[model samples]
Target: MFDSYSISELGSIFVMQGFAGLILFSVYLLMALGLAIIFGQMGVINMAHGEFMILGAYVTYFTSQAFQHFLPALFPAYFFVAMALAFVASGTLGMIVEWGLIRHLYKRPLDTLLATWGLSLILQQVYRSVFGPREVGVELPAWMMGSLKLTDTIEVQINGLFVMTLTVIITAVVAVMMFRSRWGMQVRAVVLNRMMASAVGINTERVDRLTFGIGCGIAGVAGSAFTMIGSTGPTAGQLYIVDTFLVVVFGGAQSLIGTILSALSISQTQSTLEFFLSGSIAKVITLLGVVGILMLRPQGLFTLKVRR
Candidate 1:
């Protein structure tokens, strides 16, 4: 990998790859954050989580189309509207699923997994039927189409930077909501002791429903960001599902800080390696590294001590 490159070339490669990794990191972090909340707090292994993401992508696609057809003057500003709608659409579906399907399966992790998996299949078919079986790409605004030249050999994508900024804002908001707000405190209490929380006037069921909704909503935002990087398809969400799970599990599912760190490390390592190696090879190497670390410390890189 190093044989043909000079010192300057290597530096440029690192810089460019590092930037690309940051974009990937943003996407992974967004997806994992939502999964962490649902899996860690609610103890629900939602296999259909990716479908929720793709739902958001489809929402964005349609939103862009509508804007182009009827609101061309506002096309550049359509993304914000699309993201909001995506969150609502996905989150509403999450809440409904919780009320109709997931609530009955509490304490049954395997059942939740199987149920959500079936739900995923249903959602994929629905998307295929509704959106057609073709992969669709979003039309980005002019402002997000260019790159900033940092050096002769290193340039940063404007859309990548936008996604990173969006990730930062979302992460900060989640942290504040998780740690400082009254509802966040209630969520923690429910997670630590659901029976006690219910006994003490906290609506455990409501918390569970809202928490799941928020998680899926975040995934929706992730899907919105994803459109900037890749095409959207009925099956596209599946591609990131496994990797998102790896990030969540390897980061300590309950710890937001851990999720961020894990996403950054995994994305950067894979991004850098993919430049020199095949994409599959890079992923295999990354997965092996994560497995090795997990074998040594099964609790993950960071964990919060809670009563068993």
Candidate 2:
């Protein structure tokens, strides 16, 4: 890869790729954050998580269409409304799933996995039926359509910047909610000891419902950001599900900082490698590296003290 490019050209390539990696990092972090809560904290193997993300994507697509048709003057601000609606829609579905299905299979991890997998298939068909099988792209507002001229050789995408900024804001909010709020306290208490938490007047059931809902809601926001970078399809969300799980697992699922770090490392490595190698090859190499490290430290990059 380095044999053909001059030193200056290589530097420019690296700079450009690094920025590209940051955009990928934002997506991975958002997806992994939600998975960390659902799979890590709740111990539920939700294979349908990606379906929930697609649901959000579809919601955003429809919202954009509605705004364009009925409120063209407000179309520039439609994304904010779409994202909020996405969160609400996905979160509501998650709570319903929790109450109707997941709540019954709490301790049966294998069953939850199988059940959610089936649910994913059902959701995909539903999306295909409703939205058609064609992939759909969102229309960006003029402000999000341009690029920022950082240097003669390096132009940064305006939409990428917006997505990254949104990611930072969401991550910060999640951190505060998880660590500083009363709900955070209740969530931690339930995670540590459900019976003890309930004895202390904490509603463990409610905590479980809200935790799952919030996690899915975050995934919804991720889907909204995703529309900026790629087209939405019934199966589009599946493309990132495995990668998101890897980030969560490799980072120590219970640690948000670990998730952030893992996403950064994986995203940068894969992004740079893909420039020189085939996308599949780049992914294989990244997966191999993660696996090698995990062989020695199965607990992951970071760990938290939890009661047995």
Candidate 3:
């Protein structure tokens, strides 16, 4: 497949595709971080997670429109507001869902998955009714629009770089929150031994709710980031949900480092393959490879060793 390109051309292709993969990696990491916390850490199978992301995208859309219509001069600053609002909107809804439904299905993974899937459909219909069937794209600020030309054959997008930077910052913050914060310690304690943690004066229920909310909140931020790369539609989340889940699972679900590595690996592989083959074929080959590896090591690329 590479025989068609000269050595320099191949080098440029790899470089460009590698950068493209970084953007994909950023999104996958953002989406999977929440899933890792919920599914990997809390053992909750949240099928409606994508809808939560879409909610954030929609929030960003509205935030942009408001800024454009009401505060055109400050449009460049609207993104920060949009991200914060998206996080709050999605996180608040997550907390509500926990109280109304997820809390009831804690012990039943299948039930939670089915319930969330139903919720996803409901959310999609609502989005369609409100936003219409057509996909929407966010307008970029002047600073966000263009690419940096490194050479005749190599250019990098400003937005892509921003996504990478944002991903890194968020990942660092999440890692610190998961490991260093007192709330994180409580969550770890609760996950390790709910009854013991409760006896030790930790509120397991509160931790569960907060953890779920935070996970969904991260998804919201991820969705905001997605608008830079793709158009938002009611069902756009569905397109990425499977890939996000796969990255989480292929990494050790409970390991944040594992999720990052898995996302990076899967994204680069698929992106590079896409340059040489069709998108669908690239995805198929990548998935098949992942499946083959999983057949040999079901525990995934990395796993936390804990006594059950």
Q: Candidate 3 vs. truth: CA RMSD?
A: 1.0
Ordered from best to worst TM-score, the candidate numbers read: 1, 3, 2
TM-scores of the models, in the order given: 0.98, 0.98, 0.98
Write the residue-wise lDDT of candidate 2 on 113-217 in tens digits: 899989889989999998999999999888899898987888899999999999999999999999999998898888778789999999889999999999999
lDDT for predicted candidate 2 compared with the true structure: 0.91
- lDDT on C-alpha atoms for all candidate structures: 0.94, 0.91, 0.92
Better candidate by lDDT, 2 or 3: 3
Using alpha carbons, what is the TM-score of model 3?
A: 0.98
Candidate 1 lDDT over 1-308, as tens digits, reads: 79899999999999999999999999999999889889977889989999999999999999999999999999999999999999999999999999999999997878999999999999999999989999999999999999999999999999999999999999998999999998889989998898999999999999999999999999999999999999999999998889999999999878898999999999999999999999999999999999999999798899877687
Question: Which window of ten consecutive residues has the lowest lDDT sum in model 1?
Answer: 299-308
